[model samples]
Target: MSLIQTDENIIAQMDSYMQRVSELAPQIYKRRPVACVNTFGCQQNVSDSEKIKGMLKKMGYTFTDEPIDADFVLFNTCAVRGHAEERVFGNIGTTKQLKRERKETVVAVCGCMAQQEHICDRIRKSYPYVDLVFGTHVTHRLPEFLYKRLTGSGRIFEISNDNNEIIEGMPLSRDGKIKGWLPIMYGCDNFCTYCIVPYVRGRERSRASADIIAEAKQMIADGFKEIMLLGQNVNSYGKGLDEDINFSKLLRKINALPGDFRIRFMTSHPKDCTRELIDTVAECEKVERHLHLPFQSGSNRILKQMNRRYTREDYLELISYAKKRIPEVSFTSDVIVGFPGETYEDFLETLDLVKQVGFASLFTFIYSKRNGTPAAQMPDPISREEKGKWFSELLKVQEQISRAKNADLVGREFTVLCDSTAGEGRLSGKTLSFAEIEFEGNENLIGKFLKVRIDKFTNLLQGSVIE
Candidate 1:
């Protein structure tokens, strides 16, 4: 089957979603509207915020960085960690004071946090001042929700926890014109013992491969030079689909598209990091040479407890294979410092694995007990103090490794996508290997690709543009 074929019903719904936005535009523009959206969480939430901004902009809303200055204020939230949820509460509380200052200002909250039943109930009872509350599934319903609020319906709540069909053709207001996010699939089926994603985000649902390819083509046409395909686990891209196309095939199709743009994807589970996918990354020139494969804990005992379905040996083998195929490939990973019942030896194993892998970087986190997850009920005997110490030690080791790895790039010339200008005559962009660098360049270099030579390393790689 060809890549262009998709379910007619799904396409029709996308058209309907866009049509509703168009219809709501005139009514929304009747009054001048300024919006401020504070996005919290992963790239998926960022992508959702972009669509929200697009719909709001289409309805004649301009943006303000200050939430107090906006006629409409929205929080695209995250529920992945306790700290993020706390920040959401803190920000939402501030909005209540803002509402008192500007009685006409609309305060709304949406995303993964809003999808939780307890979170919805708490907001309804305590945060009565919130104008609208919705979930991830019904993001396209913002226009309808706003219409209800404007017509004096008071507080609006529209949260759907179902694994709803993917809504395509929604308007997008990307953060950058040159770099974009394209979601190949939604939700996760991998219910890792420590995760709440499968519960809140629902099960896996892949968009038609054709739809993804078409989006990439359009992104290129729109002058995007980089596209990152997003998912909870991109390696499982086509499992639920009827089509024969898998992640590797999809990558090949996007790589073949007519464009000078670079391609990247993220959050691969070690269990699903197939041989074909690894080889495909090495083979595709447009694909970035960096992979973010999360090995939460290096102890096989902890891995089994977390239900990761892969052992330390398995993960090491995969990394070894990738490095063998592409010698210069850099790897980054996520590690949770204090998973329930993790022993000191388990933590040591993690440090040992860090040394063995020599990762470019690590996103380390203290294990936060999500209420409904299996690990929450497990024996979490580890104290906060111990977790803090372990976290610090782990970070110390990873930082040293990262510094050494970056130092190795000191004399290298890399093609950097000139993204923006930093203060004091510095231009900043990222290498194809995802090394962020600050270099001296003209302001006009923003949004263009340029070669840069690495000269020094500090907080970020300091460099100069090679003429």
Candidate 2:
């Protein structure tokens, strides 16, 4: 709804800076620059940080473990929860001392929080030690921004509101060797009443289907065993694209690719998750059996108030359909308790839904109002104490369900790609259904998918690898 304001003159200047960096590449290579990126929030922010690392690596800047030791420090931030914002401010405040210690250090802040105009203005007034402030849209131009800071003087603020630009073939520094996050789409069109995503992330725009398929093939070739398609709403993948493709078609194509890897996706809205999509997921051998469909509230009244566009009955019907089609499939969902005007009866309805669905796991949160959203302006009659009670109750119910569901898999064997080595001969990985499982194995087993027997359940599902 709100577009980022930028003039042609500023755009030209940015382009010119990039050109100057390229022309002066030989001279710039004398000193090795080190950068440190501290990321917060969701998996999407992690993916963005990987891209930032990639761009910086391309610019001949190596990474550092300590923010204070690095010549350039960047905070890739989040604004979803209030606590995450508070942590960012606290970290940035510490950077004031880091800047004072080394005056030449370039301290920057970017991501969803930086995209907010109000946040940017506040930082400019309060934290002048920050050398640069950018946003989600201009990640590809980090080298240019860095060059301007190095070759010139003063603070730089360039937070672009528009996210429509798609720069392909950007370098990436991924965290895991066996698993990777592939973003099939960018931004959100569904402005949920309590969400700040549409305001910060911009409109929904999907990558070309062919481009996605190509990236999948490349990842497979690069030895990644799993790829989770990341998006705000993955079900609505090819909405405004020129091609007549949709998410179901894309899954079919990816599954058909010759590979031994697993395919997964996240954050599906029950409203946009069509029956065809569920059938496709069931039929695709590579597609995982775990689904993260978020049902914000069970009360139809609260759902209407949030503009979720679906009823409790609709969600249950969809779950019933998916389970019948793929009986082994597991369901996970997000629940927001104590929304504006949520009643005791409404809270009971939510608990009832949790009982009926028996979700493998549920991410429950007490609703926190975000600025510039419809729910923020609504009359929130529910008090913090009442919300806390609801949150605790939801967690108790879901924990019992999760434990019992996991308890069912006590003797079952599932394939696990060893991804991490916990100390003392323990290796951690995940099953095809996205169940976290750790087993006793050596480092040599890392990156290999082996059949593991489910032995126990503690903080996470435990198992022993079978030859």
Candidate 3:
């Protein structure tokens, strides 16, 4: 697969279409056109929707939180789990009535779910009211697609295979002023049997280090206090790149930038996580003292079946090393409770690992089968009822650990970036360790960093802003 940069010609075509759409929008609407861009699944999809919104804003469209109030509605979808796809379909079904009530409403779907041929066929055969459908690779070309649909092009579906190109310089209509989502890379190389991300997102490709550094500098200058470097496997960054840099080196580069901002990343594969990365997290003052390493299963046999290249011992060793280097570091993780062949004995190992690590929290799920994946074809004798029981047990164990961990934090002080309002006369923010703490403060504290003392623990950490 050859790496292709989006050429100037395509960019010019998109610009022309953008201008046409902007000119045509006023003629079609009596008032300002409003769009509802609904996002599903991961942070990557959220980032994609922000870019779509940016393009829509340029084309003279404002936004709405309700689809019923929208002249145009776009579903930025996810295909990670069957439930997410079902939710998207249910929401789309509701929009059919809206389309009927307003004949001119432009309804569209895009992102990972739209990349699948089966999903596209279903939408075509059943959902005739939908105007356009595009895929993960052509997000930068949304203006062109929207223009065609507006000009009476019937039901545009553009789910082409992976184009192996990284398009740069798309405008972003970010959701917040304080936290910025910066995608350092795109796609996945690991084909874990339980995941459809690699199939939907395509092969791994890293953005140029210079481009990333430029974006980071711009975000800091824009007054973004937190920068989240996003990817399927962030540790796999710099692969297939010309630079000698890797994820750890990249972190150090961003940490060196002059700012009071904090850096965080996610969904790290244990196989690609290195000692250098852990040490860099320990050493960098600007980087958050939190690591979200996902150890999906604890059984070596089940892990091998899942095609997660690392073993339980390997994961434990990394945790041990991380603890030795950064004693106060907090960890969050993802765990699957019931695999196709997982036994109660295998699950005990998972419980053991969880107890050993003492994680801050866990994102736990029972394995969901995906079509066109290797795991789906495997023989299974276990029942969903049994899986449900196992899932409950895992949740119980994790909850206890989490409460104990939070209780230990009582009386400790932390510098938190207040990001949102929790309730009346309350503000919520995250500590450098990525802990959510709600405190008594005014709304003016929303974008500022302040010292807070933890006085209690309940569902979340409760604190008071230091005077």
Candidate 4:
């Protein structure tokens, strides 16, 4: 079968659960109204929510931000971290209160968290008021799920199956018109002990190169200036290729597409980051100079315990590669404090690494044990107060480094594309290095890249337009 047909078949199978619901409920009644979708977790989840919105809009439902004002409430949730799952549970409980207050409103929950068997069982048992529960693969089936629920032929339905298919031809209502999100890969195969993404999102799968390139070309045709590639682990892209065309090759291909579009990718694993990938990133003019390489922990002991498969020395070498080839390269790292047996020395190792690398920014967090992971079963005896202490220490150091990085931008010109709201008579966009900057400009300057000479940097983003 062709790609589109294969995709449609997978979507059909995912929505098959709704057929059972339809047997009990029926489609005679007709009503369509506004819905609010709450998204949790990473950019991938946000992209999925957009697809859900596109599907709902086709079904004659308007979008609303306020849940109370919306006719239907849907949650596109994440299960990567324990805290995120707790938040989903809390939201579900609150929605139950909403159903009590307003019996007519329909409540639905979908996304990765819905793929968990235990979570699914609880939602079916305790929250019978929920109209539907769907998973990652069935985003295109929202219409069918809603059709059965509204027509009085079906009760609640849930779809939580292991699916690996790429869907196309759905309308996309993007969050930002200037910067588009392009998915090159999905799911994770690494299965790090501290992560639940592998279990919920399933194995790694790469989209066909032709399909991805075509989609990106259309985005460029529509005047999008920037494209951020989305994936669980992007370095593993093109592993599905027969001739071994990797992400670096993809970068070169997209860069030579005869457009001025800027390229960016997120959440790279230090393990899969290879010499070829480094060289491509360093040399490709179209690829941005910033990298988001996530080094979860700094201590070799803790890293081994977490099954990260890389030592601190290995990470330093990767940093060395970037430093020599792309001297001005800025990097952002993910740091987790208070893992199961993290000690004072371990925390110091993290601090030392952060200082050694002088990261552009750090997404620091206190570890929250995910349920199904091996790390969760390990003794997490660290107190909340201790975790907070470690987190505060990490934050203080990262903030200083970030402030210095931003401050150094002063007396330099950066190419920024206008996107978000700027102050009165001003525009806000990101530097090619991903630094957020605020600058004043006439309305005509919007949507186009302009050279802004940084007049001031409060260690906060403030730029002045060149006269």
Q: Cα miss at 156, model 2 (Å)?
A: 1.7
lDDT of 3 at 354: 94
Encode model 3's per-residue lDDT on 210-273: one tens digit a residue: 9899999999999999999999999999988877889999999999999889999976999998
lDDT of 4 by residue, 167-232 (tens): 766656777778888988877889889988888777777877787889899989998889888999
Give the better candidate number (2 or 3) by TM-score: 3
Cα lDDT tens digits for candidate 1, 1-467: 22223346654554554456456534654555788999999999998999999888776678989998887899999999998899899999998888887776789999999988899899999988898999887887787777667657868887876535777676778888888999998889899999988887887888888788888998999999999999999999897677898999999999999878899998799999998998999999899989999999999999999999999999999999999987479999999989999999999999999999999999999999999999999998989999999999999999999998888899899999888889888899998888889999779898888989999998779998886
TM-score of 4: 0.91
Name the candidate, 2 or 4, with the larger lDDT value. Answer: 2
CA lDDT, every model vs. true structure: 0.87, 0.86, 0.91, 0.81
lDDT (tens digit, per residue) of candidate 2 on 1-467: 21222245544654565456545543643456778999999888999999888767666678887987788899999988878898999999988888888887789999999989999998999999988898888876777778877786578898876547666666688877888999988889998899998888888878888878998998999999998899999999987777888999999999999978999998689999999999998899899988999998999999999999999999999999999987489999989999988998999999999999989998888888898899999998989998998899999999999999888888899988788898898999888787888889899998888999999887678899897
Residues forming the 10-long window of minimal summed lDDT in candidate 1: 1-10
Best by TM-score: 3
**Winner by lDDT:** 3
Model 1: lDDT of residue 366: 94
> Model 2: clashing residue pairs?
none
**Better structure of 1 and 3 per TM-score:** 3
RMSD, model 4, all Cα superposed? 3.4
Candidate 4 local lDDT, residue 158: 61
Cα error of candidate 2 at position 371, Å? 0.9
Q: Kindly provide the TM-score of model 1 when superposed on the true structure, using C-alpha atoms.
A: 0.94
